[model samples]
Target: MLTKKLNRFNTLRNQILTVFLFVMTVVLLFVGVTTFHVVSTLLKNNAEEQIEQTVTQANGRLEALYKQLDGLTNQITTNMYVQQMLLKEVNGDYLGFRERQNLQQLVNSFQTYSDGIQSFELYTSNYKRVFPLDEIDLVNRLGIHWVKQAEEAKGKMVWIGRDPKSPHFFVVLRQIRLMDRWFSPGGYLLVRINPEYFQFTDFITSKTKKQGYMLVADRDLTPIFSNFVGDSKEILHAQQRTVQQNGEEYIVVKQTSPLTGWVLMIVTPVSALTDGVAILKNTILFSGAIGFLIFFIFSLFLSTMVTQPILKLTKAMQRGKDGELRPSPPISSTVEINELNDTYNALVENINHLIQVVYEKELVRSRAELKALQAQINPHFLFNTLDALYWSLVEKEEEELAQVVLNMSELFRYTVSNSKQDEWVTLYEEIEHIRRYMEIMKLRWGDRLLWNIVIPASCFDIRIPKLLIQPLVENAVLHGIGNKTDLGIVWVTVEDCHESSDIVIKVADDGYGMDEQTKEKVNELLNNKEVSSAKGSGMALVNVNKRLQLYYGEERKLVIHSELGQGTVVLLKIPKSGEE
Candidate 1:
């Protein structure tokens, strides 16, 4: 069941359709989510900004009112006539003319700056007075709480919410200090503030009736004033907080008055500022749905255009597996697909040309192998002739000469046998072959040719590539001993280096050695891995060195040293099996 379901989508068309639908779905989902989030954030930010502006305007007005009242207190305290009235004595029931005039002067001062002031009273340690007096005299003694608060304030103005037993008025009280008089307690000044003068409720009501409401609270969180009639307890204590009431969300913004330490809080509904967010959110969701459908169709079409050529090329490649080198047809709509078709055709043509070239080269190689096979017959015939010569010497009673001929024939056999096999031979067998060559040389130059083989017995059993050492021995004979007129000593040594897992072989010759230039040239040729074009002098050494390097690697190969009239030493370093 799962296989059948998977096979439905396995076709090129279905796979492309699935991919396009998945991508379009993800893109539509992302766009819808991002749009909704942006609308929500912008609405919230805009509401907060509006509420903040309302609180700022309200706080500014309240601050201005408090500043005017504060200035009124300053005016009374600085007036000399008011101070004089406080210092005067009360003589009779009715004040004397100067006393009454001085009292009126104090009342005139209150009238001058008392726009919002309900009444002003001066409380003295020695006397008392009230402006706009009633028929019944009222004692104007400072309240103990006001006196203590004023002292604590150090003569600064103190604002009180309401007068004792009076709910309709607030008061500002201060202890007047005599100017230029040290430690002087002059009198107390009290100004009754009519609550109507504030106009805070009307201002707050005008701004918040449709949206929300506003509240003013004292430092203790008491509801001093507000246009909001709902439960304002939370709003009073809230610090720019959010609250839900009656299933409605509200943002409470608070601003504190620096002058009175009163907080002005504006409570605005979340829906008021974000009125169009619902419309915007619904619009985004609807558009996203439409966009998803459109993108799905467009992506499906695009994928078909992209994959059709690829499917055609794949079919062509499958057909080519039957040994037919066919090229895919070019896609007309796509330049890249056309280029791929061109490249595929070019590759097939090149491969056919390569096949023809390899066939011709193979024919030439077969011919060369045949020629090499025929060349081996000449060496075998030489060997047979040498065997006959050895027996003829033996019959003539020349035993030493017969032995020399026998050794020469043995050397020829070793060379010709190894040429066919081309396999590794024991070091012992290689040294014995070297001995046969030395014997022939001794017969020619008799006691003048002194030679020694000082190879260790343990090293002789190690196998090395055939003909590796024989060519070096030949080089010593031809270049070293053959060039010298006097007696020459040829020495061969093999040392087994167990520590380095190697066998070190040396062939030394005491003959007319080469100069610096010749030594350098011979060394360069020996190290040269490239096949020699000219088989000139020292070609035997170069070929041997190249073989040793090929078999054992360059690190374990020939090292040659030579100097004029000194001697030549050629060392062959052979690593153990697999050590190379």
Candidate 2:
């Protein structure tokens, strides 16, 4: 559960917020850590300087004590009465009562000028000791070793340490020289000085003591006394600096006391120096978290501000695809989003305008062409029928004229009726209308316009557009039969193409057909080879051809086969599908 809550997703808002928070966190951490480090470093340096001062002051006090002790030793060695007593003791002569009393008075006088001196006594050349003894080292030979080192110094002081029997202390040995002979030693003086005698640890205050530790080492880098957690030799050997012992880091600074020859080293732990920065770390982390939260919220707002407009534009595009080609409503957003909306609205409006202008224009044009063709057929047929009736009346044939009038009335009613606006009629009805049309033309041309029609029973109920066939029959009667002088025959053949699921109709004439050039021109116009530019003989066939293609689709082609002396057949292939 905690892991899931800590996980960040790849949503736009999250991405934006993450980037902003990352940059902000980096900058804040950089600044905060840098400030903490710099302050911690400054504190360390200041503490180091203070520690060095304390060690220097401690060394000065020790140097003063050394001078005082040296003066006291000079006084005791140079005194005429004290030297006589020491000579009497070294020669094994018994000391007189008055002489011992004078020597004790001299020792009391030396003790009055010195402080923190555990002992101040002289030892004779015969190994007779006068100072305090930590137990006689006759079995260990340590006392003999100190005496031998003191004799080697001749007249100088030798500060010595490493007495296994002693507790945190050292000895100062000086060979007692004779007054008469400068290099001749009468005996040696011993001073066992406690490290706490001068109270050097008191130099470190309570606050600074918590910061680090202090150590005192001998001239050969051997630690005599140390508060550091390491072996005496380990502390002394790490004199240069930067020692890691017990997983704790320390900075070592050393100052050697000239008189005492002790290395006073301040071992300041590095971790202790930066202890004050913990508060700073907590403060920076708290403030950074608050800042990151605020930035994340701001990023979310910004992400929504950018994405909402795009979502709206996407919805508008979806509406356009759904056929709602209308302009979008006003939107309040950035400039780019507003521009995109405006452009999209404009595109939809342009599409709607094109639909209105182009598609409606095409519909109006098709209707006009159909009506014009119908009008042309009606008037031409009426004039020709009237002329044929006039000729019958001139011959005084009442019955034939009356019969022609009735047929023409029925044909006009079929073609011009306003009851059916869609002009749909079954194939049987269309064939009957063609029969009546041919009968009137046969009356007008007599034997020159004989006609025959072949229509199948199965094709009788198939519906087709009205007046789609009459014009072809009329064209064969007037052009092919009227142009010949002998008896002409018009053949109308209709067959159901079962395999192709279509109805094939042919209107042929046995009269003389046109020349090769004329036939080519007529067929070109009928086939619509020149689009809407052809003008001449096959206008009626062209009218039927266009209506066929417009009602049934463009694949319906009006095929024509003609020969100069043989006759012409116009083959119309129409689909068997219903039309209304």
How close is every model to the real structure, measured as TM-score? 0.44, 0.51
Clashes of 1: 0
Cα lDDT tens digits, model 1, 1-580, are: 9999898779877777887788777877787788778878887786677668778988998888777777778778767776555544322244455665566566556766656677777655333444444332223343567667876776688876777647677777777776645526566677777766675666665764437677877777776666666688866765558888788888888888877898888787788767678888888888988887787778778878878888887787787787776766667768888888788878877776555545543453454356456656887578879988988999999999999999978876676563434457888888999999999989888877888998887776788877678777777887888877788888889888888977788999988788988988887886664555467788878667655655554565678888888888988777655223
User: What TM-score would candidate 2 get against the native?
Assistant: 0.51
lDDT value, candidate 1, whole model: 0.73
Clash count of each predicted structure: 0, 0
Query: After best superposition, candidate 2 residue 507: deviation in angstroms?
Result: 40
Question: Lowest summed-lDDT stretch of 10 residues in model 2?
Answer: 132-141
| Residue-by-residue lDDT tens digits, candidate 2, 1-580 | 7667656365455676678778877887898789778876787788777777777876786677667767777777677766776766666785665665666666667766666565565566655554333233322424667677878888677776654457555667677776654437676666666665545565555536646677777778776667766654666776466788788777777788877777877777787766766776787778878877887788779878877777677777888789877777777988887898899888888788667645544663566557556765666577577667766775786877767776776787677653445468888898899988987887878876788889889888889877888988888888888888889998888888888877889899986877889877876676653335344568878877876766676577688888888988989877787671
- Give the distance in Å from residue 192's predicted Cα in candidate 1 to where it truly belongs: 39
Q: How far off is residue 299 in model 1, in Å? A: 18
Each model's lDDT: 0.73, 0.72
